[model samples]
Target: MARPRAFDEGEVLDAALRCFWTRGYEATSVRDLASSMGLTGASLYNAFGDKRALYEKVLERYASHSMAERIRRLEAPDIAPRDAISSFFRETLERALDDPEMKGCFVVNAAVEMGPHDPELRAAALASLGEVEAFLTRRIEAGRADGTIQNRETAQELARMLLGVHLGLRVLARLRPGRELLEGVVKPALAALDPHVPG
Candidate 1:
């Protein structure tokens, strides 16, 4: 029988995720991953296949849980839609803005760095962003019904605008902008959805 692996797969993947987060796919070496996980390159290949395969696993791990699940949780029965959105952004951008490391986003980072060159990676990135946009669209539609959001802007347009703000905010926080200035960006963007607020 084959010898059992020395390290935990989940732990190794977690380390690999951090490695990919810190160093873009092309830049991160197998040695880097093994070092991060306290394993050898041979072991990493045995456990997770080649670098490309490992990166794909990392993407799946992140998307399946972190990205997709957040949108799903917001759509849950108990949470108010607008309140859900507030909580979602409270967790995503607000935390990104305040985080000392300011890890913008794994998917966003992959999008900016590897997306243009890799169609598969680009598609994955677009899908995750689309999920966020769709979530906002649903909430905006709900807001229209509840009167939390005005009906002036089409839900599709407003959702796209908000998604753009999120992407921009992620990139913005990478520069470590002051919390006040960063928070200022949201009020104006949210104001645009208000019927009384000027365009």
Candidate 2:
């Protein structure tokens, strides 16, 4: 029979996440993960397999707690579709502003840093990004059906554009976390949703 592990899995995983978030995957080492996770090297390997496996776990954890939860809250049936879209961006902007470390986003960082060479990582990163795009597409479709979003573009097109804006905002925030600059970036995209606003 296998022995039960002694450490708190959630706590250690969170620590590993912080380590990876602070230092990109390529830069972070097994020793770093062990230190941050408060586990010996042997225990780290025995429990989590390896760096790549642990990183995959961390990505799953991040998506569940961050992206999945946010989508669930903002996509509630009672909220107006347009409002949900607006609130999504508003909350994203707020989070970017509030991040003192300017870590940007874990999923996005993974997509850029390691997604190109690593197929598994690439798929994982794309899946998270696709979730956001899917959410935006759904909301835009709803808004259009309800006559609230008056954009000329199809829901998919608008959703893709908004997803680009979302990615750009997070990346730019890392370089310049200024409120005026970020809000300026968002204003025009949001305006595109209203027909009354002259294109």
Candidate 3:
């Protein structure tokens, strides 16, 4: 009978995720992944297929635990839509500021680095981004009904705009990891949706 592998798979994947997150797909060699993941080169290939395959898994892991979860919270019925958006941005800013290296979103990094050539990575990135946009659209519609959001645009348009703003904020956080700078970027973006505040 074939023997089962010894190492904890989840632990190894977590280690690989961190390595890919830090170095990115292009710069991170399989050797780096193997070392960080506590596996031999042969073992890494045997388990995860290859570096690209491992990175795809890591990106999905990040999406599930981070990006998708945040979007899921935005859809919660208890919170006011406007407040949910505000809280989301505040949380995002805090997390970005807290990161010493300011690594930004791994999925965003992968999408850019991989470009259009990698259909799988591109599709994964777009699907995650679209989920957040769709969630925002739903929340905006709720806000309209309850009179929380006073924006003139349709929920779909507003959601797209917010998605763009959020992505821009993520990029800025990597470039300038200061609270003031990040806050300055988000304040007006949120105000654009505030009925009490003029655009």
Which regions of candidate 2 are displaced past 4 Å?
none
Deviation of model 3 at 18, angstroms = 0.8
- Ranking by lDDT, best first? 2, 3, 1
Clashing residue pairs in candidate 3 are none
Per-residue CA lDDT of model 1 for 71-180, tens digit only, reads 88889888876677677766775678666877778888989987989898888888888889989999889877877778566899989988888888888888865687
**Per-residue lDDT tens digits of candidate 2, residues 112-169?**
9989999998898899889999999999999889988887678889999999999999
Query: Please, what is the TM-score per model?
Result: 0.90, 0.96, 0.94
Report the alpha-carbon TM-score of model 2 versus the true structure.
Answer: 0.96
- List the lowest-lDDT window of 10 residues for candidate 1: 190-199
Model 3 ranges off by over 4 Å:
none
Model 2: lDDT of residue 80: 93
**1 or 2, which is superior by lDDT?**
2
